[model samples]
Target: MTDERLIADLHNRWVFGWERNAGDDPFDFRRVFGEFYDFDSPDVRLYDDFDPEQRVATTAAGYGSIWEPGFREMISAHHVVDDGPHVVADLGLAASTLVFVARITLPDATTDIRTTSSLVWRRTPDGWRIVREHNSTKVLPAGALDHRLPARRIT
Candidate 1:
């Protein structure tokens, strides 16, 4: 297969794996990425200096406490509102890296959040592997609110 096709297939598989395993088991790092990749390495970083270890730590801490469990769950669900073709903006053969962007909608409690993600992939001996992923979420307003009293009223 052509380099472009290979990269595209890798991206799709990476996203699918993340969405599938994230839902069932958030701690299964291997399921979310290629066997050779490591989320803790400085080479891999997330928003605000958040690395894979930090993310795992946050997830283990608790739900809605400094970390959003829903977000993790959403990632696992990998729900895409509209499936569209992904375009490869640039390819660096020497570095074995491919950069591309994908737009997807996530299923939220009340609003469907749209997210555009940028992924960096490197060609590995085994196959194409994702080295980095940055996701930005756009939250939509909720339509209605429950009139019922709060489960626990705050002072």
Candidate 2:
């Protein structure tokens, strides 16, 4: 009904699809990508699990390589904090922050990655298209990626 509700729903749908898309047998990346990405333009960008120190762009052929075969299956359990809409002055654009506490199950370990992502949304003729997404993750200690989740702090 409201703008906030719609945005939150979109985000949640993406997360759900991501969790269900990949499996031990084969990774259904097409299904997962179809749910949220805009494949029509080269303007799309996803800073996936990125650290500012290292550059990993999940764009173009890079996406295919990142989710290639032999990669371990991952399960994502996330809760989003909706911060509502923030519009850019005079620009037909708005943005919001979806704070995610994601417990990601890797092949060897499960880590709670506290991520705060800012989604830059624009009202397109088709609907609200995410023009950009910048994700930042909380720093964790070495060997702290297990299920224990001890002394986990959110930044």
Candidate 3:
């Protein structure tokens, strides 16, 4: 498969995992995200706007833990890829960037968040594994999410 398609598929898989446990509020976040990252890498970096400390997660479980609390009360969700899964590949390494918009519901309120994420992947013995990721997000104003557009919606 082409690198672009492969990366896009990987991103979609991650989103599937993200929205899969919306009904299970107190779900095992680590288990959901276990297949997405490189666990053997000693320096798997995860940079997120929510994490000001700039910590590096050596394992996929550790990366999932960072978002566990934030996703604990997610009632529903809709995630759409707004921009390109722009990809560049060289031998066993690949980099992909994706811009996505997500509308998420909690017990108290609903929020629309747009994020631009870049992921660095290594062609592992198992498959392509994410070794690094950086994400920047902005919470949009109320009514900003357009559900009419095609998206993966979990209700």
Candidate 4:
């Protein structure tokens, strides 16, 4: 396949996997990461040059931190602002990385938070699989609280 097609496929697979994980279905690390990821380790780092045998361990550690209950709850309400073909401005490969920005409107809250994320994928026999991902969040500025009011007034 052409490099462009390969990259597109990889990007699509990654987005699908992420959306599925965010859905109501139980989060299955094994299914999404394959048998090469280890969920018990304290350090999970994904790398293209790392030993294949140790990949699972690193992936588990890294994802465990991001997929914790609190994180999931925060992400559950997120709304995707843009989801499409990536520009791939500097990355060596077409789908080497995907950049997307989303907005999360919290329930019972007036301010909405915007989150930007990037997902990197690697091609394997099983097809394109996510090798790494990072997400950053930003919240809208709020009015200053009255100092005279109770400490709880600071919201």
Candidate 5:
């Protein structure tokens, strides 16, 4: 398969796993997070919903804290690659935009959040790994997420 296809496939797989995990009783944090990121690379960075302004250096282990347990989360995700997997020497670069609606069910109340993320992937010896990520999220006022778009879903 072509590099672009491979990268797209990888992105879809990760999204599927994320949705699957969200529905699981005991979410498998390591299975998805550990395999998807380049922990060995000291350059990995995250500018996610937690702190959008700060470009925090992150690792596979660090993700455990961010995805904490307590509330149950269910997400419907869509991924779109707007540009190329422009190969630069030994590195392959692909930029993707992901939109996901997460339903968080707590003991008292449930809230739905819509998040848009931009990710920069780097091809590594292991496979494609996320090198940089930025996310923006907002609480949905109403309505369920539309699943009509061509995207990966678990439920």
Candidate 6:
């Protein structure tokens, strides 16, 4: 298959697997990490705008640990933004950028967060492994809380 299609599948599966677990909260780390992470890289980074101190994660385990069994599980709804996932790749590198909106239900309140993330992957012996990712999030306005997405699924 073509590289573009392959990369898209990789991203889609990684995302769908994560979102699917929102029902139970705290998605399994090993499932997606094993398939999509470059465990040997020793410098996998997950940059975020909300916390400047957490801009980069330099270890494979450290990066994976960020999403492991955390408050992210309270996600009541999640959807990939339509017309997003602007993907590009060349040589042995690929990057997929997309906007995701999720609604989180806390103990007393529910809020919507929209995050735009760019995940960078490298083609390795283990196939496509994510090496780096950067994301920025903003609290959505109360009126913009629509969770609708296109009917067809990517994966």
For model 6, the local distance difference test gives 0.67
Kindly provide the TM-score of model 6 when superposed on the true structure, using C-alpha atoms: 0.77
- List CA RMSD, all candidates: 9.4, 6.1, 3.4, 10.1, 5.5, 5.2
Q: Give candidate 3 regions above 4 Å deviation.
A: 20-22, 51-58, 146-155
Candidate 2's displacement at residue 91, Å, is 7.4
Lowest-sum lDDT 10-residue window in model 1: 145-154
Candidate 1, residue 39: how far the Cα is off, in Å? 5.2
lDDT of 2 by residue, 68-128 (tens): 4423354433333434333332245656665655554555554555667776666666666
Q: Sort by TM-score, best first.
A: 3, 6, 5, 2, 1, 4
TM match of model 1 to true structure: 0.50
- lDDT value for candidate 2? 0.52
lDDT value for candidate 1? 0.40
Q: Choose the strongest candidate by TM-score.
A: 3
lDDT of each: 0.40, 0.52, 0.75, 0.41, 0.57, 0.67
Model 6 Cα lDDT, one tens digit per residue, 1-155:
87777887777666565454334745557655688888788667877674535646776677656655444644444556543667799989999987777655544455566888788999999799989988888987753665353222222
* TM-score versus the correct structure, for each prediction: 0.50, 0.62, 0.83, 0.46, 0.67, 0.77
Best of the two (3, 4) by lDDT: 3
Residue 12's lDDT in candidate 3? 67
Provide the lDDT at 82 for model 3: 84
Sequence-dependent TM-score of model 5:
0.67
Compared with the true structure, what per-residue lDDT tens digits does model 4 show for residues 82-104?
A: 44555342234223434343333
In model 3, what are the clashing residue pairs, if there are any?
A: none
Structure candidate 6, residue pairs in collision: none
Ten-residue region with minimum lDDT total, candidate 6: 146-155
Q: Pairing residues by index, what is the TM-score of model 3?
A: 0.83
Please report the candidate that would top lDDT against the real structure: 3
List candidate 4 stretches off by more than 4 Å. 1-3, 9-57, 71-75, 87-99, 103-111, 141-155
